[model samples]
Target: MFKLLFLVLLAASVHQARPDGRIVNGETANSMAVAPWQVSLQTSYHFCGGSLISPTHVMTAAHCYQRFGVTVHFGSVSNANSPNVFDVSTFTQHPSYSTGITTDYDYAVIKMAQSASMNSNTQDIALPDDTDYTGQTAQISGWGQLSGSGGTPTLLQVATVPIVSEDACKSQWGNLRITDRMICAGGAGTSACMGDSGGPLAIKDSSGKWVLLGNTSWGSSSCTTNTVSVWSKNANQLSWINGQMNS
Candidate 1:
């Protein structure tokens, strides 16, 4: 989760409920079969994660912004070899998003400067759906850190976590109120860590296609296991995303 807009987008803002970019207790991913739509949002280095929603469009967290520019890299699990890259043609965050917290309207859209090259390992994920997904399991992936102080992985890392009930999710968040716009997941050894902001938290649909459900927004300060990670819900943002990304 992307913790908060915390200053320059990637520093201390990540608190008890902060934006993060890591996969704890996750396995090295064979991303082609499991996470083809995943992309590393890089600028000098890998800073965040995102999902391809169309050949020229992407979905990410608003807090993953860079003042200069960002490049989208994909088509391979190993970050060292991801050959396809594209400059952003446009970057749009929900108009109502705030800086205090990276929850609610923390989502954003990115348009590649040109049509992206798609292949067996590089493709688009399903557009978001209307389902609540409160009790279902979803997959989380990224090239962020392996732990709070661990080295970031060169290969993609993935973990499956069950979405926590909204009530349970809120209770766990303590002072940071869990809004309807935030979907909660991960309360076990598997959790997200720093650098995983703007990444996807998704589930397979009836057709077995991964559908975007949430965007990593924030997590615990230590990114320890058993801490629930928060996501920016996608269902409520369908109209907003469809209208803005196409505009």
Candidate 2:
């Protein structure tokens, strides 16, 4: 599984200054529409991100954890808030994770020392049972910054994109090696970018539950550019995700 490169939004340079004055291409906002406790993984020392999957487990790109020591934040999206930062006790990247090549199994989970407390504002999203998300429209929500040149939003941002065929995605990417473990979303000129990794790609299931179908992964540099999202929907990995969550 290839760790997608973090693309910093170009707009962030104007609104805020990162610690080292390094501009990251992605941004996110704090919004009441999303659960208040839905956390974004961040670090004072690193650039990658992660998502809170359960009260205690965070699902994120394996490389994000490997590259930066795992640290999860809850209750608030800003670093100013006093957050409970827990070191990852253990993590399991897909056994076939590849360093240089993009693979369908670019997913991993981190277990924290203690479980997160649940409330109306903090809860775990459900996961789909199988790879049955053929033509469903899903909503991806994140506090990640917007665009490669913008500032992170103060409110959580939510976008709706339809699921696309893997074949079509491969065609868009000049027939790159798109595997069954992945799925594509966004339009010809819209998508998720940096700081959005490990976020949920959720759709309403047959029971009307917002079940997670994919985790935010790599895409093109710009939202206006055609981008393909690599997901963890491959048969074996999907099973593992469900099994880990006991879904």
The candidate that achieves the highest TM-score relative to the unseen native structure: 1
lDDT of 1 by residue, 91-139 (tens): 8888987655335578899988889777888778877677667778899
Q: Compared with the true structure, what per-residue lDDT tens digits does model 2 show for residues 53-78? A: 67877776654545446566665545
Question: Relative to the true structure, how large is the alpha-carbon lDDT of every model?
Answer: 0.79, 0.55
Model 1 lowest lDDT segment of ten:
1-10
The C-alpha TM-scores of every prediction are 0.91, 0.76
Q: Which stretches of candidate 1 lie over 4 Å from their true place?
A: 1-15
Estimate candidate 1's alpha-carbon lDDT, on a 0 to 1 scale: 0.79
